[model samples]
Target chain A: MAFASSRSRPDPAAAPDGPAYLPSSVRNMVKLVVAGGLGVGKTTLIRSVSETRSLHTEEVMTAPSSRVDSLAFTPRKTHTTVTMDFGRLTLGESGETVLYLFGTPGQARFRQAWLDTAYGARGALVLMDLRRPEVSYEAMDLVEESGMPYAVAVNDFPGSPVLDAATVRADLDLHPETPLLFCNALERESSIDALIGLVSHSLDVYRRNTGP
Target chain B: MSRRRDPVRITPAYLATGGRTSARRALPDVLTRLVRVDGRAAASLSPPQHHLLTAVDGGDLTLADAAGHLRLPVSAVRILAGDLLDLGLIQAVEPAELPDVELLENVLDGLRKLKKPA
Candidate 1:
């Protein structure tokens, strides 16, 4: 629910002279999902790392289009509009790659939007709040079911309980290979580290799948 | 006319797409970066189609971005963009395969640099 009101200055990378179009050298465009439960810091993390302000895009879908599990919760509504937040990061020395970070809306009724954002994504970074770990379960499950590799970051809020890492991992039922880290979503460096963890883990997963 | 029904200000998706739900060729996902190939807008093109082209005129914008600019659903943009693709008026630069090791490495390197203080 919090916006980046504290950071009033513009990003240096996105200065007035920056190129609006993708550099001709750019050949790759990757999509990464930033997901979590309601009130989690998906948007905050994206705001911290993205060169541009996070954008909200709306999708209108029929109620029946959602999976049965979601349908059961919203049977009365025939049509709905869901909005998702996204940010863009152009990386590498020559800007040969761009990463699109999509923050999924927090609600079971928006599963269709989640799937749309997850489609063709390389990996996902799932944020959790240790104070209410159970709220993140659905996001983690959706990420896993999409068959893409993912990393989990515990977004630290002030005064949040410091639970044992192993106990939290076991409660989440995370895989042995999944990368788990702690991050403060409001900090640009911390958010970037969480993204680094995800991309690194994704690289490992991709290598294992394709063989030496 | 039932008091004109609040004046139909927004263009319906069915009309914008000419009632076509799917394209003949496979459409790119919402995240796909699309660029305009032809700057000359066809006189026959609908307003929504024109808005889409203007959205991606010089810059590379994603299908979702175009939809947001056009005030239409992503589904409608997909169909409209497919029409443009079929006409060879635009190009889609599909993202590299997710499993491409080199691409992942490039992204990792970028994040590392970003982690450093600016």
Candidate 2:
């Protein structure tokens, strides 16, 4: 994956010393990030919600022997997301408004970028594959570590066991308020609705916790 | 229009002063001008750039370092860096020296050898 860089230096005529200001009217945009493990259908979820061009951010997956056991499985898996994946969406029909959706790399080795992506995010949608529910823990640790509230989207893979929400909650040991729902990521409506549910739930939680 | 030249008039006292005061006074003025001009253009973050920017806002990585660390191709990172540079979200520091291609080739060659059945 190519990391996008600026080909030319900043124009001297336009160079500013500080952050450019957006009008206050445009400042209310919302950002929602979709984070999950590799092959967990994060890309599919974003594409389903917003077909707009998504930024393909790829990071080298390095095997960190100090953390996870890199040699346990295939020797071929090299280079992980040192960065993050990104996509964009517009909530409702107002084209003027926008939602920035970022897909964080799931491996524990890429925790630096994952934590970075979670910064300033109101919440996150942690996608889980029911077949390997154990994998959900790493993603959960990231959200919890970052102190960002999150909702879980269980991607129901075909032929995978369909566990009830109660069982999933128990297996994952989720707090009562955390939103957990099943989704067929391959289906557009299902994936999009899953995101909508997450965002709405997160907003409610934020409002209640912060008051107003 | 006829040109009129003023007679050269430099006193010993003026020469001794060495024009240092005037040059020193202009330094701050020039610096302030540069800051004001650069500040306005630095604020807006493009969507994808914003994601990348937010990822690095913690100051853990420099722009090029972030790009290399991310394993994104240099060109793509260059493009994103340009956007970030323009918005003043990030500043370009010196580029890291390229790693030794020969060393990398040797390492890969060794890995290839390891994969072969003994």
Highest TM-score among the candidates is held by which one? 1
Q: What is the lDDT of residue B24 in candidate 1?
A: 65
lDDT tens readout by residue for model 2, A1-212: 00111112133235221222222222123456687777788887776544343444443334542323433344667433344555444333223333556776556656754654555565688999888767767877878787776889999888788788899899889999889988877665576667666756665666566564
Runs of candidate 1 with Cα error greater than 4 angstroms are A1-21, A63-71, A106-108, B1-15, B18-24, B39-41, B97-99
C-alpha local distance difference test of each model? 0.76, 0.51
Fnat of all models, as shown: 0.57, 0.04
Please give the TM-score that candidate 1 achieves against the real structure: 0.85
Tell me the tens digit of each residue's lDDT in model 1 across B7-80. 22257765777766555656547777788786555566777777676667758877766665566667778888
TM-score of chain B of 1: 0.74
The DockQ leader among the candidates is 1
- Candidate 1 docking band: acceptable
lDDT of 1 at A115: 83
- Note the clash tally of each candidate: 0, 31
Provide DockQ values for all models, in the order shown: 0.43, 0.03
Which run of 10 residues does model 1 chain A get worst, by summed lDDT?
A1-10
